[model samples]
Target: MLAELKELFATWIAAVAAAVEAVMDRLASRRRVVLQEIDGDSFTARLGSVAKGAGLRPVSFRLTPHGRPEPPLSPQWRAALRSSVVEVQMRPDQVLFREVDFPKQAADFLDGMVRAQIDRLTPWAAGEAVYGLSPPQPGPHDRIVLMLAATARAKIQPLVDLAAGLGAASISGVVTVPADETAGTTIRLFNTRLAQAGRLAISIPRLLRGLLIGGGVAAAASFAVSAYLGARLDTELQDVQQRLNQRRAALRLNQGTSSAELLLTQRKRSSASSVMVLEALSRALPDSTYTTELRIEGDKMQVVGLTQDAPSLIRLLEQSPQFTRATFFAPTTRAAEDPGERFHIEAHITPYFGSGS
Candidate 1:
């Protein structure tokens, strides 16, 4: 189960990484403008120019506070803003900046932690504030320092609305710098548009589309591998089954040209043979003795016949190798139709007569 979770996490990471890389590549090739609002009636505009080592050098131009170009350069500047990504910088007085200290452990969740404390950090309530945080820096002890910038939504909404009305593609971010501080200490108030309901609406879909295409490709590859393994397993099973069938056929062929019935008959003949027993009896008894009835049951034999001397017949039968325990079962008596005496004898038949005789 842990293995499956790790695999799922890896897939998501790959998808997100791919999406970010695509967006970054697109942005790297494009130019952008920075608009710094000085007052209600005027602002400074800087067009970004690519420098050595993929850096940007801004070319500054002043614009009217209405987001239109000023003086002789108005038309050219207006056209540039429409085609480039716009970042607006507001005056520090229009936004609020506060330094808040938090435990170093809260670094991972600084955004949520700071937002939750916004009401206490500033006079504005959470709903009335548009806020953002600077990257956390080391504090005095085991704590981290963050600069939280916030402003009433009413104060910043009008400027965003004006930029949208001027046909800007999208407002990227809003930052502010105190007149008494250096440019490095600029505080970001709002990184997303307040006038638009969903920030990154267009970019979100583009990233999602890239992720979907990558996921589809991964799914297709997995299916192809599964199908290939399944087919290979099936083929191996068939080959094994065919080999077993061939071995069975070879065994049947080697057993001679007989069906199941013929094999059974041969086995029965080898176990017991009545003809061999009869031949052994004929050799053991004299021609002078005549038999009227004879019966063989398993290894025992019974005889009812006429003999010149019935008592002597027992001795003769017992002396034979094929018979044992010869004795008279009934009394010998002379009969009118009989030439001599009528007698009954019984004996055990040896198994040697069945197979060897």
Candidate 2:
């Protein structure tokens, strides 16, 4: 059981190593090509370029089997052919011919050529016409060596349409190089190995131009929005602050007015209290005793007098309703000639009454 597990582990390791090596080889290899091919019934219309060390070798070829007859060429076929670079490579049992042809000015002849190429390529190149062209370079004419992958018209056309829709100035040529360095390049290799053989280098100039235009518009919009919002916020903040200041100032003025009113009300109350105290004293004094001096100090009243009779005055004060618990100062008798005695007295007067209390 341990040996079996070891063998399985070894196999997995070998597979992993092989995959890593394959990826490294692809990255390091310099072999590449670009091709555009439209196959015919008896011949294939191909447009391609071989990438040399630095330059390009333009090539076009039509591969045909022996004993097979050549198809007639038409105007549309000629138009397609006008843009080709051809080369012939003969096989042991097959004849390979490559040529550029121009259809006669007549419409019928052009139509015939188009039909002929279409019929010939039907078995090998089915469905819609396939276009695969390569990036241009100079290289060997013996046979176009290819990377292992090929280009697909279905894939390449959308890219072409995309470039056209965006109003691209030009579309880069398609590549049909083989991923295998040893196998000679062919239509089949271009179909199968283009993803490996091809390099997709975008147009730096076009991209930069788009970015500059788009970026400027975006930046301007952002700045305008920021400035507008900032100004609006500033204005709102100022309005709120102004309102707060006004409210604060108004509050201070109101408080000062309220304080003055309170002071005036207190003074009026004190004056009324004085007037009432004097009135009460006048009403309560006895007939035998007339106050000679009346002094008011805060809430206390003092009375000094010379009465016709001191006993009568004392009795009158004690009986009065206004004075509470009166005390008489020491009385001073007059000289033998004088008529009456003098006395000083002090009394506390109630300032105001609440509920008869």
Candidate 3:
């Protein structure tokens, strides 16, 4: 059980690692292409420089307002733009900038936070404008300061469309920086795209595949456990049934009969017998008393007879060891033709006198 759990954990970890590596590789393959809008009429294009170990050099180009080649780009520039991730810098007047202070904890969610503040900081509502922010800078007290940049979606969409028409693989964003400061912080105005919006869609199938594998493993383990428990319970039930059968067999061998038959015989011997009760009554009653009807049910006996002295019969029956609690059930009366009174007596029969032993 422990080993199976360990294997499952290891499998999940490996799956997660593989998914992370795949996403990282996809991001690394994307090239950064920058375009700085010089004026409404012209723009400068450049390939962002690669890191030291990358063994690549930067290439630059210029394009007219109509997207016609100014001097004609080299083969490398054309190739780079075709597969590159594009970013366009808008002229300062074309974009709006605002400085806002927020809680430190909101740093991670600045894009959404800044978007919510767009209508308050600018004339445009959040949906009407395309907006982005600079990296948060430390502020007074515990707050953070950030530069928010926004432009009308109408103004930004044309540039984005142009970049796409020029064969850029994806548009990264629009940025704005102060002209005087060479190292001025750039604030992004828009970065969201249809493809980037659904980036996680690529990982959905991979995640589902992993979940299915894990679910299958769990189901198989559960089935194995259920089968094992069912077998164990069946074995236990069989063992109990076998032990009960053995006990019954031993009892039959010792008693010379099945348990039910032995119980019936013993009950008959210990219970009241009609014949034995009659003999006991005969000895208890006077000669003048004669029984006409007698009935025995369970431990109770009833007698109907003609007696010279009906009341005396109760005392006589109670004194006998075979009967108890004797009493007249019917009123005693002298009959016109009979020599004695008609009487009915009821009593409990004792087990001792009826036992054959």
Candidate 4:
């Protein structure tokens, strides 16, 4: 149960972070690097310039067979890689591509569906391969066409691992497939950036959409809690009012009985209300204090409660206009199971006829 609670807390934190990811993007490093994976071995790279998403002229690097680039890089390039967004585009021949059609309604579940049948569709099992799907395209008979690209993890792990080892700020694996009649100009097949700093990550537009969705969900929850509390408070107020009405009716019945009855009625009208006493206590007590039991006898009241500082409660109750002569009635004690000190306090409840109601 504790493990589940911790996991739930972590998930909530992650969701909150994701909701505010857009604000974080404003402080992110924009330096970019595009590494073109060549011959399943080496790469030709381009560094980002003043222009957004554009890179400098591509430079060929002598690289090992699907391993590290040869001749350690200069400090300048290494430093750039530390904060640069690195995108590795694999050669078309490196990835296996296929087209699959499904009911358009299944578009949202395409990732799970493709992954489930990956072994049958590709040469490798799901776990053995890195896979991705292109944006769905509308097809005949209420269907959608999806392009699937998959490759052995062994083929891509080296490049991703190398980028991370070099301390690339962010890494991505991308592949280009031969576009068909159904496919427009763009078809993004795969992206795997589990490098030192994780992937290039979710896009800004998606992040903003998530923020809006989270806001909507939070607003709905607040409304629900507010409505529930409002209903409960109204019910409590009505019950208190009903009790006051019953007391007033009983007093009126004995109004002209005798001199004793007249004095009793006057005393009853001038006495502090139990509801008012409770309200005053609730407002005066610190949030850390919780009352487990309460007793009212004549003009005095005794309350048993748990608090972080039992002695401080006396001063608080005494300061309130509704209570006075606050003192501990029983010794404060702490039990092994109790979270805080438990104390019994007695206070004089002052009567005031400030309002007839």
User: In candidate 3, what are the lDDT values of residues 1-357, reduced to their tens digit?
Assistant: 999987877667656655674575476676677777776545677667556214435433445444555676666666676646778767876677777889998888787677777889988898898877777889999999877777777665665665555576566456655654223777666653323323443455467667879999999999999999999999999999999999999986978756788899889877877778888889999999999999998999999999888999999999999999999888988879998999999999888873454
| Model 3 stretches astray by more than 4 angstroms | 1-30, 40-42, 49-78, 104-109, 162-167, 174-176, 179-183, 192-357
lDDT of 4 by residue, 75-141 (tens): 6666667756778777777778888988989988898798899999999998898877878889899
Question: What TM-score fits each model?
Answer: 0.46, 0.24, 0.46, 0.49
Candidate that would win on TM-score: 4
The worst-scoring run of ten residues by lDDT in candidate 3 lies at 192-201
- Give candidate 4 misplaced runs (Cα > 4 Å): 1-23, 50-57, 62-67, 179-186, 189-357
Q: How close is candidate 2 to the true structure, as a TM-score?
A: 0.24
Clashes per model (N, Cα, C within 3 A): 1, 44, 0, 0
Candidates 2 and 4 compared: the better one by TM-score is 4
Q: How do the candidates rank by TM-score, highest first? A: 4, 1, 3, 2
lDDT agreement with native, every candidate: 0.69, 0.45, 0.74, 0.76
Candidate 1 similarity to native, TM-score: 0.46
Residue pairs clashing in model 1 are 41-65
